[model samples]
Target: MANIQWFPGHMAKALRQLRENLKVIDIVFELVDARIPEASRNPELNDAVGTKPTLLILEKSDLADPRATSAWLRYYRQHNQAAIAVDVNDRKLTGDLTKAAREVLKEQRARAAEKGIQSETVRAVVAGIPNVGKSTLLNRLVNKKVAVTGDRPGVTKKQQWLKAGKDLQLLDTPGVLWPKFEDQLVGQKLALTGAIKDSLFAKDDVALYAIKWLRKQDQLTALVDRYHVTTEDLSLSDVDLLLAITQRLGFKDDYERASERLIFDLRKGKLGRLTFELPEDSEATDNA
Candidate 1:
């Protein structure tokens, strides 16, 4: 009941499924967007049914700022949070989370033996906000792209489970946009990453955010070089930078064109692997 925003009907269904299944699951391998971990998680996930141990998988690590991801890993683990960074689309990159998850299970199995309930494999529910790469991660773990992959938000739309390994069961779900959506930066980050529908955001505003982030990363030269533009006074605001991009990218509708290109660059790594919101912005209003 937090002031969260953005839950879709399919997501409401997925949440019901998670609620029913939580009683049976051992732990949660929550797939958080590496680029926006704080924003990607749902408060309800922590408040699920029972107090459950969770292994936080910062998905799409390859596309996130390595330093920020590392710092986040340290921050979470320091608080005794089980976490790992991973490129959900690549198995080789996913090994760390798989291994880390198993380690947690192994410890749990040992402890369970003392309680006369020898739990061998771990049943973990993979939860995250819509479009946080849940399907991509599930496919890598199972060595197949079983779940549907798409560019827009709310792709999974339901609950599905897979036999990932000998001692691990992975569940891919489409539950994320909770009711409130309180923080502005969190919502903006979600929108930037495609967790929210494009129609919900002003493309010009979203595009401006991308431009500001890219400009700060010093990757404006790439955009400028690609479109033959000059960055004479690079100290412009987000809107001005986006206008420059519009002029360079040559999209008939300047705003629409710049927005598309900006999103494309981020998705394709042309703008550099960057994170939109920092930990400092966690308390801000939900901008989406």
Candidate 2:
């Protein structure tokens, strides 16, 4: 497998602009995919965000393991990080957003009240890496298609504030990716989950990675059942298992096509509700 790195010129400009505009921002809604929470995060946001109040939203919770999501939320709270897991399509999305924002900005809101300043609306910026569902969440909160959305990365190209209900204003920015990936496994995880462009990495490489990861987690049953492969087949090496599944799917020796199909199914939740990283796998535990 080759090194996976994608940092377009526009992403660099977006980070610089994000820093410049942080002063007017009341809160930052940092979104990450629930399935690959750690890998989908843009580390550069820490420095750019500075001391801004932030609500860590785990988007696409509907597609992630419920148990893992709850555990991750617990981990965040234990670390004093304000966070919430949400499905963008939920009717209570705006309500949840308002509640989480209020909690995170409790002290600030109290200070304003002490000064006799009554601010009704919260001004927040939705920031995250490519295709982590920033635009989709904004549209859901605002109750309209304010930003163009797609299944792939880099769908958002610019920034603007959209009115989300009566009490919230959301500033949506382009998905920002860093210049390099120090840990290539992080890159592979991102690539497999549709954060990075598929053009940057081979489908077979990501598919093999997914197979090995699933096996390690004891979650390979879904794939085996979906593809109708045998337990004897599971005993094979990762690459051999992929090839065998490819043959079972009638792809013959075309492992790349089978790899693409496998990746697509995984992203669409065809395999099952899967979370790429567990709480125990976090860097703070020295196991990541």
Candidate 3:
């Protein structure tokens, strides 16, 4: 697998801004892709926000496997972290996010009361990697289009503050990725989920990685059902399987197009609900 690396100048500036503003922010609303929560998390940001209250918002829950999401939520809760799975388009997102913020700030609120100060509003900064739906979540929370949102990464170039409600003020920051990925699988997972720009890596390489990973999860049935391919097709090598899938879809000579389409389908949830990594798998990797 190719080692993917992307740390643009804007990301460096964003990290500096985050560190500078950390002291003023009451909590960090860290948005991560539900499909690859571990890979989507920015370790540099986490270290910068050390000891600050954080609420992990697993955005795009609709695109992830429900069972895997549940397990992750349980895992986070056990580790004493406040995490919630949510889809930005859901009607209840506003209330759910508000409740989560307050829950994370409960002790701070109590301390303020003890000091004869009463403030209902909680100041939070939303930090995450590119294209992890931070802008979408912010827009949904504010119930209007306050942030520039797109399907691709690097949509938000700077920081902007918006009022979410009477008790919540959110600072929407540009997504920042770390300088390097220690795990090659992390890079592959990020690329597979569109958190990283597609132009950084070959579509066919990413498609092959996705194919092999999905096969390991025994989740290739979605691809088979969607493409009308047989189980025998799954037995082929990653590259050959993609070629076969493309041939079946009448793109016999356009394997590149087929690979791109397959990746697009996975990103748009056309293939099915799938998650790239699970807590158990990460835990095992850590142990290894």
Candidate number with greatest TM-score: 2
Query: Over the stretch 223-256, how does candidate 1's per-residue lDDT look in tens digits?
Result: 6656566777366666666677677667745667
CA error at residue 175 for candidate 3, angstroms = 0.7
* Top lDDT model: 2
Q: Which ten residues in a row have the lowest lDDT in candidate 1?
A: 279-288
> What are the runs in model 2 whose C-alpha is more than 4 Å off?
283-288
Against the hidden true structure, what lDDT does model 3 obtain? 0.90
lDDT of 1 at 143: 79
Q: Tell me the TM-score of model 3.
A: 0.97
- Say which prediction, candidate 2 or candidate 3, comes out ahead on lDDT: 2
TM-score of each predicted structure versus truth: 0.87, 0.97, 0.97
Candidate 3 clash pair list: none
lDDT-based ranking: 2, 3, 1
Superposition error at 74 for model 2 (Å)? 0.2
The local distance difference test score of each candidate is 0.73, 0.91, 0.90
- The 10 consecutive residues of candidate 3 with the worst lDDT sum are 87-96
